[model samples]
Target: MSTQSVPVLAANDAASYLDLGITLALNNWPALTLAVQSNWGGPTSDDKRAWLCGAISEMLTERPETDAEDLEDVLIQVMNDEFDVVIDDESAAIVAVEIMEMKQHTDRGNFTEIQAMWEAYQLKSQQKSASAAMFKKVDAKDEDQETDDESDEEGEDVEMGDAPALVRAPREKAEPEIDDDGFTMVKKKR
Candidate 1:
């Protein structure tokens, strides 16, 4: 059974349908069997019908608590591997119909569980990104404020410590000279 022949359904549609079918099969066996037999051609040899059966049953019984896409991915893998037999389009259509019928029995509770899990995951992801972005903004603001404060302090220090210009005038005014008092001392020269 080569995998090249099986038709691929759209991601969302396929996931939803598989989830629904599995949900339904778990609740009712006889009905599920009838549904599968009616649509799928009883069972094919050299192909894995068990996965299809199991998927049907589990969907009805367990009703996935997580990603529906994950469950559908499992189904696609099984179909490609275990049931890769080349069949006519009509048979494929029949298989699809059976799957669709099984989907009808999907438990609402399963949907709710899966949906909640997905939503939580998405919310957590959003929160993480938002926090990171906010931190970046805050850090930038802090850096800017620090730069401003540093510049202001440097300016004040420069103004107060400008002694070169003020000290020269004071030193000239306090002219030191040799007076007649027999001592070299600084005097207020007129």
Candidate 2:
């Protein structure tokens, strides 16, 4: 993604960038152990300097505004640059100022925004599922009542009346029960 001329990465993908801190020291930063240890590159003192220079150059091309005073500065800027691309510091150090493999990345601003949107999407999705579940339960209850009504049709012969039947149920009469230990029990009917 592109934002303000800097490429943006999805927030989820960009979390790795934060994990790989720009200041973390690579093998060559301390000494040229590769050439001397494994009989590979980083053999000479100059070779060590070359590796540092190459890393610096990689940082420069990726971020043009990355003006640095020395090797340390380059590392800092590249690690923090918004372009998200850089020299693969995770790779072996060559003791010469040469180009390294470029690793691309997203800027921080875009990543934060994308992360927020992802959270909102998840919340809305949850709410919709809950509402759907509630409606399903109501519909299931209605279907059950309809099945009971169909079975009762065979038992009764309902004679048509002059007036339409009231849809409302007859209200039960309110009565108070006397339990004072001095009254006889009685029942009433209407």
Count of backbone clashes for each model? 9, 6
Candidate 1: stretches off by over 4 Å: 1-109, 155-190
lDDT of 1 by residue, 114-172 (tens): 34433554576689789999999999999999999998888464546645644443444
How many residue pairs of model 1 clash at the backbone? 9
In model 2, state the lDDT of residue 136: 97
Deviation (Å) of 128 in candidate 2: 0.7
Clash count (model 2, backbone only): 6
Best by lDDT: 1
Alpha-carbon local distance difference test for all models: 0.47, 0.42
How displaced is residue 133 in candidate 1, in Å?
A: 2.2
True lDDT of residue 168, candidate 1:
44
Q: What TM-score goes with each of the models?
A: 0.28, 0.29
